[model samples]
Target: MVTIAIIGRPNVGKSTLFNRLVGKRLALVDDRPGVTRDRRSGEASLMDLEFEIIDTAGLEITGAETLEGRMRAQTEIAIAAADCVLFMVDVKVGLTPQDLDFAELCRRTAAKVILVANKAEARGAESGVLDAYSLGLGEPIGISAEHGMGMAELRDALVEALGEEAFADPLAEDEPEWWEEEAPELVAEGDEGEEAEAPPYDDTKPLRIAIVGRPNAGKSTLINRFLGEDRMLTGPEAGITRDSISVEWDWRGRKIRMFDTAGLRRKARIQEKLEKLSVADALRAIKYAEIVVIVFDVTIPFERQDMSIVDLIVREGRAPVIAFNKWDLIEDRQPVLAELREKTERLLPQARGVKAVTVSGETGEGIDRLMKAIVETHEVWNRRISTAKLNQWLSRTIGHHPPPAVAGRRVNIKYMTQVKSRPPTFMISTSRPEALGTSYTRYLINGLRESFGLFGVPIRLGLRKTDNPFAPKRKRPS
Candidate 1:
């Protein structure tokens, strides 16, 4: 796919437009300037035109040793590698000295450039659109990434600028690296017709896993262990990490994006604005994560704060696996590990039978088991059940313990079918759906989990009344 870099000053809606094109909230968006520190890239498709888009940190002039300077260096790398550059300007704020400076940098790069005037839907932005001509990058395209206007025109402009590069080979650009990992045999009905068969499930998008826990829980240490190097700054200090940094890696041929987030301190203790931003960033990481590894130091395994973080992960419906860090420090490994398992099962029974792998973040023990558990839990989360099998299981379950009656009328459960997965939501058609109690809902949820080997994943059960389509026009009578 062609690479397009969204280069602009801070808070110009670059991340927002990135999400708009990628069709997911892959990048975090906030009103505060410099919220995005690292460069974020994702595969984006816009109205049949597919490309890889990189959202870079906002440009600024600072000392080379400073944090802002490091951010500028990453953005420059993105600009250099991209086949096309989107020079975004905030139409509402108009152009500034920084905008001119970045425009000059883009011009020097000599890459195909497209000037995008974001937030152009607002009033009085016409002048800002007119002023963009002074930037010396051809004609500026007036568009609103927030309101999603002028996309057709934007597509046309991209095609105009990139010309042949605008159209990429779908197979080469979009086809995932699944065959590189596993080669499934092809099936044919005739004599010798042979072609490669693609995997039924999509293993393309990197599985996004966020490592989160209380302060000083060895979250960063565990990430460094995974990387086999000191990738993230680690110390004895609490809250060493202030921003959510993500790294992409291929583990056992399965691509994964691991997010090392700031320690989530208690709300009452968060006094500084920077800490508040860190917590928000951490929460955003959890929201988009497929699996959340709740890293815990074995020395102090289950604090109230740790319990709250695990509860939050479960409540968010992300598959969670507890990685007990610093396991090498423990003396009585068997009993202590057993108690840790007991505490997890007792405290977070909502995620019944949660996986807890003992690992030494410093020594890298049981890291393989932890990775396996993560992949297993993700598969359970993505499980889909056939309608026939689901109904069969539900019927067998209800027969053993029938639904309790309400107001002396028995609730009739007609049928059950899975509506979706990735948190495996199912719908149960019943006569008196509203009459069912949360207790009964819990029963069905537990049964669904147990029967389908859904052990630790969250199951959402919904009750929908089966309507009679052709029976009785008398429903609306008089």
Candidate 2:
């Protein structure tokens, strides 16, 4: 993959352009200088071409022992490793001596450099962009990263610099449509029939997964472990991240986009505007995600707030997997794991037996198991049942236990078929849809879970009242 490093002095719109290429606000962008201390890498797309883009800290002169110095060290590493470098300059502020210094540094690194003159939206920007030639970094690609001007030219330069290897998705081809099948019909029991099936999951498409939990539950730390880098800022601070940052990576040959969301706190406790925004952003991520990992600090275990978060995800109809972070901190692993498992089963009955993998986000323990659990749970969430199998099971279940008599009359269940997956929705045609008690629905859901191997994911049962259409027609004919 072609690696492009965005390198420049502070406040040069490097992070802004970084967010643009990645197609989302994954990096924390502020007007304040030095807001980005660590270098961040993401899968970036310039039109059809895709490659890795690294957002590094602004270059500064400081002792190697200083924080800014260490940050520059990180940027240096990125520059050396990069196949090409995007040397950014704030055209609005004009080129400074520091820009020339960084330009010389890039020249010494033996990497192809594309000079980007940012903030070139105004008429005056032309003069500043023209002045960029003094640095001798070749023609500047004038752009306004904030306003998104000149991307077509930027795309051209990137394709030229990175050559044919920097291939973009063709503009001519349309996005592949997700396949849909006709709803299966309720045929006679034991009759062979094709089940209504969801389109096969396009695994090539990145699986959108969100990591969420209470304040400082190691949500960011766990994601950092998965990425094998300190991509997210982590410390003793509870709510350092205010935006839901999505990082795209390939795991075990399958593409996955991981979202590191802000820690969610109780609504009453959210008094600050920033905290409220953070919570809102996190909620948005949950809705967008196909799977959510509800992380827990193993030492603290399950809290009432944590259960509420899980409830929210279930209500949103997203697949959930429970996980414990900081497992290395726990003593007597076997007993602790057993107790956690028991508690998980008892507390979050919404997703019974949801794979509760324990991992040390800081130490990188049990990460593989956590990943496996996520993949398996996602598969189960998308599972569909054949119409014949569904009816056969429903008939047996009704025969054995049966819905309880409602007002001295048995509520008839006429038919059942799967309407959807990705939380596996089913529609049941019944004589008295309202008479089907929550208890009986739960019973059916539990039976479906056990019989069909859908153990942990939420199963949605929609009741549809179907009256005989031909009955009215028969009466009119008479």
Candidate 3:
């Protein structure tokens, strides 16, 4: 794909424009200048064109005596790799020397340049937009990226400069249409006469998993042990794993893709630009994983941050299993395990009956058990409950503990169906979904998890009020 890099000075709405073009908030946006420190790349489409768009660090030619020089180096690297450059200038500030310098740099690279004068929604910036012509780059496109103005003109400019044939709009929605068309091809070989064969589980396919935890946890060490080498540099340094590193390997005849994420610190400690990017990357990895194994240090297994991470995994509807790493360092095992179980129940009541396996990565003890837990969790993650069995369970559970009376009227939860699997989401149609309280939702979710043996896998319970289609619409009085 053609790579287009957005290069400019700080606080020129480059990140905002990046988010608008990509249709996702992959890059962080803040009022402060220089919020984006790292280069973030995403596939973007304009009209019929598809290409890779990179949001680069703001250009600042600080002398080689400071950290700003290092950041500038990173930006230069991105510019070198770009097929085209979107040279953004702030019309509000108008024609700074930095913009001119960056424009010169783009010219030297011999890459296609599209000069954009951002923050041009107000009438005051028209002269600045005109002034951008003197930079020797062609007429600058006046755009208010934050307000999403002038997108059509910007699209035309991109197509004209980059060639219209280079662009193609990517298939819309989360799932592509080609996947539906190719469903028959994805069927298993032996199941020709079956209604529709499920996709075969390829052992060669990477088993994507994330290792997540709080700062100072043994996440890095556990990852190193899993790989049987010091693949990731580890030390007494906390939060050393800054970015989520994808390490591929074959584990016991199964191809595994492990993401060693950075230690997620509290929001207060995440003031640094690099740390913020690291956290965002880790969250992205968690969302992309098939299974998430939260690695906590045995000494302090269920800290607030650790529980928060687990809660996030469950909320995202991903299969999660807790791994107590550094177990060899723990002095008291039984009491600690008992307390940990109790805390897990209290803190993660949503993930009731989730499995927590104790393992010492340093000694390789209990590694087999951890692997077994992972396979079992994977099975539950992919499990689909039959409609008949689900409704039966729902009926029995509601019968045992009925929903509370709402304002002298009793609410009725009619039918339940497994909407989707891969964390096993269920949709329940009810007479009054809005009246269902948090306590009641927990009761149903717990019952579903316990009855369906969905331990260690996140179970989602969605409540929807069934609309009465047969009921006549109210007629307006003439």
Candidate 4:
């Protein structure tokens, strides 16, 4: 895929446009100039084209021999590596000398340039839009990056510049030409399709696990113990992690892909827009993960925000394993563990029977047990129940305590079926879905967790109202 870079003077809405195009807040945006100091890369697809887009720090050459010089050097490096350069300019501010200097730099680089005149929503931007032409670059595409204007033109320009063949829609056509041709006989048709092969399932693929928690909770230290090296930078400072980093390795011959995310803090503390963007990126990593290990500091385990994070993970339908790190620091380990379990159970009642492990990131104590818990949780996450077995369990569960009456009418849960796994989701065909109380839903979810051996995995029980077609339609009295 082509690599595109957005380079411009600071405060030009380049980061805003980057977030908009990437369909996520991968890049930080702030009203303050020079908020973006690093070159952040993200994958973006415009229409039919997919490319890696890098959002670079705004270019400024002040003090020819200082730190500013180093910053300018980084911007130049990003420009050199880009396949196409998006020269962003603030239309409201008009064409400044800094903008012209950057435009001249782009011209010298000879990179394919798409001049974007941002903040075009304001009145009287036409003169500045026209002034952009004097830069000797091609016509400027007037846009309001903040308000999401002129995206189609931008997409068209990118496709045209990147080559139209690269932007062809993959789903526009049906089957490929090869599929229409006659299939060659492989040991004749009556081979029983190689003994009726079972549905393809990959057991060897590396388990994608994400270790997440608040900063200074020994997350980095735990990762070091697991990898047997100081792979991630760990210090006493909070918010040391500024980006989501992934490390791939094997544990007991089982391939694992582990992602270490920046500690998530309350919104008020995350005043810096860059930190906010980093937190959002961490949440994205959580969503993509198959299993999530929520590491918590032993002293402050099950804090309100920590529980909120766990709730977010469960709500996202990902299996969670609670790991209380820094056990070596706890003075009374046994009582503390018991109290921690009780607090976790009370706080996160949604994740009933969830696995919790205690380990010391410093000494590597209980690391093997933690791994075993992860494997068990993963098995539960991928567990499936047969239709008959589910129906059997459903009968017994409802028989024990039937759904309560709503509006003086009995609410009947007619049937239950497993819709999907990887955090099992079940659909219960019912008469009145809206009437089902939260307690009843919890009851069913707990029942599934217990009967189906779905420990430590989030279970979703959906109430789906099924229309009764057998009942005769009431004829209107004429």
Candidate 3's residue-wise lDDT over 1-478, tens digit each? 6788898999999989988888877677777787665566776765556678888667898985454555567677778888788899999889999988888988898379899999999779998999999888898999998888988888888888888766644544576522121221222323322423234434444478888888778877787788896555466657656656666677878878778787887788678777788799899889878889898887866777888888889889888888988888878888988888888788887677777889887788877888778877888887776667777888888888999999999988887776666767778889999898999998887777778787777877888888798989889999
Error of 1 at 146 (Å): 17
lDDT of 4 by residue, 179-242 (tens): 1223322222233223232233445656888889988898877988999976665667677666
What C-alpha lDDT, on a 0 to 100 scale, does residue 278 get in candidate 4?
Answer: 78
Tens digit per residue, CA lDDT, model 1, 136-206: 99899988888789898889988998885557684574455421222322222231223222124555545
Best candidate, lDDT: 2
Per lDDT, what order, best first?
A: 2, 1, 4, 3
Q: What is the C-alpha lDDT of each candidate?
A: 0.83, 0.84, 0.78, 0.79
Q: Can you tell me which runs of candidate 2 are displaced by over 4 Å?
A: 18-74, 94-101, 122-141, 150-208, 227-237, 240-257, 268-285, 404-409, 470-478
True lDDT of residue 327, candidate 3: 85
Candidate RMSDs in order: 8.7, 5.2, 9.1, 9.3
What C-alpha lDDT does candidate 4 achieve relative to the native structure? 0.79
Comparing 3 and 4 on TM-score, the stronger one: 4
Using TM-score as the measure, name the better of candidate 1 and candidate 4: 1
Choose 2 or 4, whichever is better by TM-score. 2
Candidates 2 and 3 compared by TM-score, better number: 2
